[model samples]
Target: MRKLLVELGGTRAVAEMHDDIVPKTCDAVWRVLPVEGMAIHANWSSREIMLHLHGEKILRLPPEGPVRRGTTAPGDIVYFWRSPQMSRGKQLAYSSEFQRELSELAIFYGDPAGGGLAADDPARSGRDSNLQVSTLFATLIDIPREFARKCEDVRHTGLQRLLVTRLGQ
Candidate 1:
C-alpha cells in the first residue's frame, strides 16, 4: 500500500494505499496531543456523518449522534469510512480490524439502548484495551484513482463525472 501525506487546512495527515480500480474507503489513525488544535467539520448523511478537515471531507463518521453514545473514551481517536458495497445495494462498510475494535467498545460501554448500537459491528470477546488518539484525515468517501491513469494531467477537479469520462482509457 502506498502512503501519501496530505495537507488539510495546514494540518498534515497521511493517506493509506487503496484500490485504484474499484471505489473504496480508507482511514488513517494518527497521534493526537493535548493541544493539537485540530478542527473537524462534519456533514450528516442518511446513514452516517461525513467529516471534513480544511475543505475536504476525508473521514466518514465517529460519534456523530446515537451511533456513539458512550463508545468513545477520553483519549480514543477514530475515523470512519463509508462506501457503496454491493451487499445491500449500497451500504457502509469498514475494515474488519476496525469493526472489531468498535464492537468491543460498544460492549464495554454496557451496550446502550438505541438504534445506535444496532448498526455497529459485533463485539469481540477478549481483553479491553485503551488506544491512543491519533489525529489524521481518513478517506470516508471512495475514489476511482485509476481514472487518473487514463488522463495526461492527473489532477482531480472535484467532479467525479468528468473524471469518470476522461479516465479509464
Candidate 2:
C-alpha cells in the first residue's frame, strides 16, 4: 500500500492508496506527486476541497476497478475529471486550461460527504452518471480534527495552498 502526504497550511494527514484494487489509478496519481496548488472549497459537494490540476500536471486517466459510484465517506480521496463539454459556466476558480476541461484531486473531509449541500443534498447525489469519472484511489488513515477544520475554512476564507506528495520521498 503506497502512502501520500497531504498538507494544507499547518494541517497535514496521511493517506494510503488502494493499490490492490485500483493499481492503474494509483500509479497515475503517484506519478503526479508533489502537486501543490490553490485549493478551493466545493459548492456542490459538501465537506470537500479540490486541488485543480493545471499545466503539465493534469491527468486524464480512465475509470478503473469496481469504483463506488455514489456515496462517499469522510477521508475519501478521489481523482475527478470533467470533460470539456461539461462546463457549467466560467470556472473562475480554475485556470484557463481547466475552464473547459478539468482534472482535480478532491478530498472529502467530513460526514455528509458526496452530498451536494452542507445538509443532505439529493440534487447532485455524487452519482456516476453525472461525472465523467470519479475514481477513489486513496483514503486517509486518520482524519485529524484540525485538518478537517482547515478544509472547512476554505469555504469561508478563500483559496489556500494545498500540497500532495509521495510519502517517504
The candidate maximizing TM-score is 2
Candidate 2 regions off by >4 Å? 95-97, 117-131
lDDT assessment of candidate 1: 0.23
lDDT of each: 0.23, 0.85
For model 2, how many clashes?
A: 0
Q: What ranges in model 1 sit over 4 Å off?
A: 1-50, 53-71, 86-115, 118-169
Per-residue accuracy of model 1 over 44-116 as CA lDDT, tens digit each: 1111211222212223333221233233331122343322221232213322222222211110011121234
Q: What is the lDDT of residue 62 in candidate 1?
A: 34
* Cα lDDT, model 2, residue 147: 97
TM-score (all chains, Cα) for each model: 0.20, 0.89
Judge candidate 2 at residue 61 and give its lDDT: 90
Cα miss at 102, model 1 (Å)? 16
